[model samples]
Target: MTTKKLTWVSMLLAMCVLGANFKLLGSIALDSFPAFLGAMILGPVYGAFLGIAGHFVSALLAGFPQTLPIHIIIGFLMGICMFIFGLVRKKAMGDGIMVKAVSWLIAYIVSVPLNLLILYPVLHEVVFVLFVPLTIATLANLLISELVYAVLPSKIKNFGQSKVV
Candidate 1:
């Protein structure tokens, strides 16, 4: 990666960690937004790196390494989903709400089983119904990230596209 790309990746990784530190709805955090931004701007590979590193760092900072796998998997799924949403759909990609919705839904759908099967005992509570809050938090995360990306100057928003292509 170029110096500029590395800086942006570092910034986004910090954003994810900070986002994870704050719970907007129940226990759901806005951490995935930065990962989505990475995916939308830098592509799936960088996005996955952001998600993985961000989750790992956050887990360590929070002193909960045991659940690292769960968070890591969620971030990986977010990257893949965002990549597909942005590159697929003919009309509703980029900053379109449909893209965000699709990405969030796909990521969340994949996360549920993973969370239920592995992280359930860790949380020590019923886990199935939390999807509602998770969905809302995810929507909020993507909306905030997309809005920020939308407002950036076109040049900056298109920063990594040339490199990507």
Candidate 2:
């Protein structure tokens, strides 16, 4: 696909995934998978764009509440995290497993603080209990992103290869 098409596809996919995975204030959520997948398959810039688009959609859907600025900042940071994940993957340090593991690690490290201190505070309208859901959601997203990156495309590719064979 052309770059523009790829970007559009990635953004739309991210939005869909975010929409599907959204959780209010309870339970862990794995909303970052699409952006992570986009980062792995596409490039950092596209990943960032996809993340931003997804966040924007999610924020809009959630309704413009008091946390609009916080959402925007979180969205931008998420884009940066995805972009960095893409960059690390592009380095091709080892196999896909290692790349995804490290990328997930990086995302977790960055997201934990941002989610707990920044996003959650805005979300809960309080600061004390912010870490709970943020931690849960971030971990969930990390695991989900890693698994999706590790399995999805390869599964499809294997199925295609087997059919061809």
Candidate 3:
């Protein structure tokens, strides 16, 4: 990638790590804000990087309460979620409102099945416990990211469009 692109990614990565400090519950935190931002700005690949990296950082800080392996899988899932979030936004380009609504809805929608695929089997009884925080965090993360992106000046918002995001 170009140096400029690298710098933006690095900045977002740092933001992601910083966000990892704010814990909502267990390994869930506000880190995905930067991931979503990176998705919308730098592209899905970069967003995936941020998502995985952010989750790992959050998990690490939380002492991997759910185990490293679980967190690792979750990290990868988060990466894929970021990828789809960016992909949807990229595809639904013109209408900003629709882009935000559809992408956020789709991201949240996909997360359920992906999470349930493993979580339901592993924690069949208590799996429902995570749903609340997951929903809260997911909405907060995406909404905050979208709001920030929406408010950016047109020129600033165009920062990485040419490359992909």
| Candidate topping TM-score | 3
Give the per-residue lDDT digits (tens) of candidate 3, residues 109-140. 75655675676776676557778888888889
- Candidates' TM-scores? 0.71, 0.71, 0.92
Which candidate leads in lDDT?
Answer: 3
Q: What is the C-alpha RMSD of each candidate to the true structure, in Å?
A: 3.9, 5.7, 2.0
How do the residues 38-77 of candidate 1 rate in per-residue lDDT, one tens digit apiece?
7767766777676566555555566643465555655465
Clashing pairs in 2: none
Give candidate 1 misplaced runs (Cα > 4 Å).
Answer: 24-27, 82-108, 111-125
lDDT of candidates 1 onward, in order: 0.64, 0.63, 0.84
| Candidate 3, pairs of clashing residues | none
Tens-digit per-residue lDDT, 1-165, candidate 2: 555555546564755465535765532245566676666656677677776766666566656443678777877887888788778876665546676677777877666665556666456655446466757766776666667656765643232113221
